[model samples]
Target: MRASHNQHLIHEVLQWNGVIARRAHLDLSQTIGRMLRAGELVALLPGVYTWARWAGDPTVRLLAVAAWSPDAVVCRLAAARLTFWPEVDHGELDLAVSDRRCSAKGFRLHRRRLPPEHIVGWPLLGEDAATDGRGIVPITGPALTAVDLCAELGGEPIDRVLRSRQARLADLRGALECTAHRSGNRDRRRVLVESRAEPWSAAERKGHRLLFEAGIGGWFANFEVAVGGKTYYLDIAFPHLKLAVEIDGRFHEDDPDQFQSDRERQNAVQLAGWFVLRFTWYDLVDRPKVVIAQIRAALARCRKLAGIR
Candidate 1:
């Protein structure tokens, strides 16, 4: 009967938080310890235990890592994701630890002493995370994450964040400026400078250069249009021809909100009597000839329609 009770207790905790720490199992008599030995519960880390069923879940694995390293702040690719920066799905967890060596399976460790201002403490997933018995996991702020990622992985994500208007480049510049005294900040600073000069997507940048080199004229980057009582911006626009070009990246397909918003914006642009041309990252980079041809063809058609040629 006691064994049955222990099994129920272990299952309950696992269901609630996906994992349980040794300290949390202290109150459940010595049953949890026996269960660990019996292989009913898997030790994900040193003292963190999860139901064998949940041990394979990536999110649960990350939470286990978080539970193991209480003092470390979530950083790197993981931090970028939490801060809404564009990135591919990361396979391993990343954490920034200041002191007291920290390591775990499925985790990449980074050594850095972050300032309190740059660290944001929040529940593991959301505000209601506490209800699931998950503790707060400190994450690097968006600006710091942006700078860190830009330094290491190029500034495409930073440009995405800027174009989305979810964050300000000036604030990122401020963060980068403040961190100038830190080690290996030169690369980050250089990336920041370049971003300030061209604050948009890689596709847009390449498209703009292609158009310029092709001697295309009378077009604006990020042209603003008002339709359906809302203001929308085009990635690139030829005002006289009422033609707009949009450079899309993977994030549009991955994020439902962005996907829906793009659809609405495109519909509005069409209703406003504008000819919209769309190109993907591959379209702009891998097939510049095709992109240029399409734009030139569209512009010529527009000119004919408007009787300008």
Candidate 2:
């Protein structure tokens, strides 16, 4: 068959899905081989090929990468972007493998012996079954993703993920125990420590640490109270004394809506007869001594008002 005729046939097959694997049939194999040789088709993997137009697309590239190595699991930023936290940015797709290598251009490869618990199976939806073959790709779970990124980007990103309810501290610890090596052990441990061993936001965690270090006790993190028929959580609260402490981070200042919501929540807490104390990120971080002293004064006032010792 003429190259143009073969190219037309290849486009016809590719139209169903933008990518496909090499087939065993003689005539079809010869046509695909000719197209590849002529640079009309791009080979993403040993047996995988796609039309040049689809090669540059990230989703298509991810699909191709996943299809190329069923054993490989997507990790770090790529896995974070796939889950509850979709805003994670990285130029290269991270894939965890066991000593295997790929010559693909846009991948940041990590060759590690990942435990089965670290790897979770996920389906790539909206692809042709014939091309994708069950469409199951292995990727790192939320906890592992947090640990992976924490090693590189530090605790802020992991703290954000945990605060947003994207991952849990218990899971992060488990992954750390399973996967953390000697080189980055301190960073991993620092993330856990800076979090004050809590799953809340970075600022709240710092506040918890400050309170503990100052010998303050009998307060609960994420204390729940009902207000206006809706249950609201206080960053830190002494329920018996009817006192609530809110730790506001940079997000509150950056997002006007969040700043307004903080005010509304404070009003609702006060309406429920609780004394509310608000502190900024800097108050807990840069001015921990002052933050603790203020909390102590507030608690003493609250106790005297409530007729407590």
lDDT of 2 by residue, 1-309 (tens): 475676676677666445676752235677888778878788876677888777887667677666577677888877887774688676788887786566567776777778897787666655465255655568888888887777677776677677667677777778888975657878987877776546367678778878878889889888878898988888999999999999998576898998888898899999889999999998877888888888999999999999999
CA-RMSD of model 2? 3.0
Candidate 2 error regions (>4 Å): 1-17, 23-27, 37-39, 126-133, 180-182, 196-199
| Global CA lDDT computed for model 2 | 0.77
**CA lDDT of each prediction against the hidden true structure:** 0.77, 0.77
Best by TM-score: 2
* 8-80 per-residue lDDT for model 1 (tens digits): 9778877777788887677764777888778878887778888877787866776776677766787767777
Question: For every model shown, what is its TM-score relative to the native structure?
Answer: 0.69, 0.86
